[model samples]
Target: MSVVDPGSTRGRIVAAGIELLGTEGARALTHRRVDERAGLPQGSTSNHFRSRAALLGGVIDGLVAGELREAEAVHPATAEELVEQLAALVELLTGPMRVTTAARHVLFLEAAHDPALRDRLSRDRRAYVASVVAVLEQLDAADPPAAAEALMALCEGIILHRVARHDETDPRPAIAVAVRGALSAPGDG
Candidate 1:
């Protein structure tokens, strides 16, 4: 029999974990389920990721990478232009990106209980904040780091609100309001 590469098995397991995170949320994420979804032996998932937290860490990293890629798609030439970019990001969060962000929340809550997990979460979050700051800086926004931190908080808050209410109200207006507040001139600060 031809030997299947271990790397392929690892990829499949990670893919399965991502799908589970999106569809069933964190509770349904497990080695057995990931193994079954990936059509691999039950042991394969454990072999690749020794612990549940390890697997979750991988999923979080993947999700962050995906978000960074999506964020990159919205470019702004000026602080005013960044408002539109921020709106675009909010729309993306309120729509297709909802699963990723929502699932990330679940993972984040889980991380809170585990110091190792919390460290991973904090590092990934800082990276994301830095990416946002870089984008805002490119648009000549004053206090890009602070602006990015505020924007991330706004996005998370909007996601929580939308998820809890399940209401049809779009989050764009609220996000725009927050962004405008963040991007207000230094004199206003």
Candidate 2:
């Protein structure tokens, strides 16, 4: 849960790693490349992260910390407000935070083949879902955990479509429908 100081050398290295992954893909995520991207002296990244696995772990940590910070800024009082916030979040992810989002997607693909990375992602994902479940409970959802999972899946799908397909469609309407559905009881449909 500790935040990495962006001004610190470690932070710079992690940021550089994200940028490299997003722009140049996984193959370019070498220590030398990260050092060059961060404008640090050669071997600086290696000094901080002894291996590529360690470096990837650091990047995942940095990404989760930053995304959690952003998510914390959004406080929704009701289901409707949550819909708006979620839509805004989608825009933010695919717009201003595009590179970071892309970097996350890259890590997600990498995690599919790496057990340690997948475990890290799953842990973070559970923490994030728990926070959403708390919000849903406060909003009077019949099944807060399930509702939160659905909402998260909806947002992730929208973000993936927008980011991977270059789709410019407005995501609000779909978000509204999903949010309302999640908040509704089984027989209320």
Candidate 3:
């Protein structure tokens, strides 16, 4: 991950938003909370983001940027490689990146009443799904798009479960099974 500039007021506010989302969920996502978490003067967060939707947009941007930065290069042609990929991803989804996973879910729930958040998520969702499709194609799946959707859904399920439980141990084995099942015999699962 890139180093966040602490001196950047906007970055600090966004980081605070992520922290709040992770630790306190959507209810604590107000600008006042972000200002307190960021150690900024009252209303400073509003000065930067203007509104809750805009603040949520910053959090989405932060998460999406991190995702792009940490994305692995996929070149899987065998079950082993695909399983390994899934294993690493499961580690991230269930381990050190749990905060990000949680924050994303918070944003997802908040998106139901926030059009801007919904739009932002929709844009990122398309790119993320497309990335999965490309990887499935590289794996030479018979139906790359279908397999991608299944894998994406399976991945989301894993993230949601891990975030809900806050489990420490790696859940890679279970994730591997699901991914292999999804990628097996193209459209089979």
Which candidate leads in TM-score? 2
What's model 3's lDDT at 47? Answer: 95
Local distance difference test values of all predictions, in order: 0.74, 0.89, 0.76
Model 2 Cα lDDT, one tens digit per residue, 49-160: 9999999989988888888777766689987789888888889989988888999999999999999889989999987898888888888899999998888998999999
**What TM-score does prediction 3 earn?**
0.83
> lDDT of candidate 3 vs native?
0.76
Off by over 4 Å in 2: none
- Model 1 scores worst on lDDT over the 10 consecutive residues at 1-10
* Candidate 1 local distance difference test against the native: 0.74
Q: TM per model?
A: 0.83, 0.97, 0.83
Q: Is candidate 1 or candidate 3 better by lDDT?
A: 3
Candidate 3 per-residue lDDT over residues 33-138, each given as its tens digit: 9999999999999998897777777888878776655554555677677777766776775678778778988888878987777887888888777887777777
Preferred candidate (lDDT higher): 1 or 2 = 2
Q: What are the root-mean-square deviations of the candidates from the true structure over C-alphas?
A: 4.6, 0.9, 3.1
For TM-score, candidate 2 versus 3, the one ahead is 2
Worst 10 residues of 3 by lDDT: 66-75
Cα misplacement distance, residue 159 of candidate 3 (Å) = 1.3
Model 1 per-residue lDDT tens digits across residues 88-119: 77667657777776777777787778788788
Name the candidate that leads on lDDT. Answer: 2
Which residue segments of model 3 deviate by more than 4 Å? 1-7, 72-77, 167-170, 181-189
